[model samples]
Target: MVTRREVRLSPSNLNYEDRRCDRCFAEAANGESWPQGPFPGIFAKLDSQQRRYFTDRSTSDIDPTLPPGTLHNGGRVQSAPHAIGGVDFTIRGSMDALLRFDDGSVGVVDFKSSTASPQLGDAYRPQLAAYQWALSRPASDDPEEVSVAGLLVFAPESMVDTEQGRAYLVSTTWIP
Candidate 1:
């Protein structure tokens, strides 16, 4: 009997060469090693706050281009395991948010933190595209129609001393 190995793919993985590294794929398939990163507590807190704000208000003060929609918080999205080059792979990701538009379309939004204004360069495009692809899949809930995808980047613009303590001036940038 022929056996097909399973591998998991994520948006972050897609950011790196579309997760085509044979060695990494093999390791992940064997359940030996997977991607790891330093914990981002501050970013997580900020992301949670923003998500809650949008969810509570049913709107976003940051991105005006976003249509009237209901914000769905972070969740796991996955594609059925499939074979690529004889290796079975399941593309999956924890999307930051999915906006279900009134017109039966969905919008993908990713939150990013940086010291300077975020740029929509080559490094980040694949990650956003992966989210767009995941949301557009027929298996996804709702209409599964991806109308738009974007990044909501938060950056520190300045620092100032206040009566309480030092405060940083933050700026938000939306890149579609």
Candidate 2:
């Protein structure tokens, strides 16, 4: 005699490790693993650059008294952190960040750090797209649409792996 086990599933409660896209999910069962990448500093550099541009373009409209960092809900979204569905129902990739602008427009921004060019990886595109989709869920308190955006900040390392490194600025991609 064989015993049957009841299984439960949900987009929100899904495990990040087991989630996967259609291709991967069809090929294999859910596995335990986290998205791999460098530290957050690389992404921070790119964000700093983007903010600089925002400041420049909206110099006149931007409130001078706004706090130093992102001011949305006192940066609660960034500070506290939140996660939605994965790339698949419960099996591959997870988005890194969800950004909301001051104009009531929500957007998805993925931070990528690479020694080489960002074009070398396809993961960045789908990963960001998945994030935008998850953030755009109707039940979610998130706004209607999160303009998909990808930022690739490349930082060349020193020969000895030291903090004194060189950073090359690349163009930021925004999907409106």
Identify the candidate with maximal lDDT: 1
Please, what is the whole-model Cα lDDT of each candidate in the order they appear?
A: 0.70, 0.39
User: Which RMSD values do the candidates have, in order?
Assistant: 3.5, 9.7
lDDT by residue for model 1 (65-158), tens: 6787677785878765556887876668898877778888877778777533334445578887777666665244643778878776778889
Instruction: Determine the C-alpha RMSD for candidate 1 after optimal superposition of all C-alphas.
Output: 3.5
Q: Judged by TM-score, which candidate is best?
A: 1
**Model 2 misplaced regions, further than 4 Å:** 1-94, 116-118, 157-176
Overlapping backbone residue pairs in candidate 2 total 6
TM-score of 1: 0.75
TM-score of each: 0.75, 0.40
Put down candidate 2 lDDT per residue, 1-176, tens digits, no spaces.
64432222222223233345654443343343445577578556666655554532331223333222232211212111233442324212333343455655554444434443445334445545544554544323543455434533434343343367744444333322
- Candidate 2, residue 95: the lDDT equals 38
Q: Indicate the worst ten consecutive residues by lDDT in candidate 2.
A: 71-80
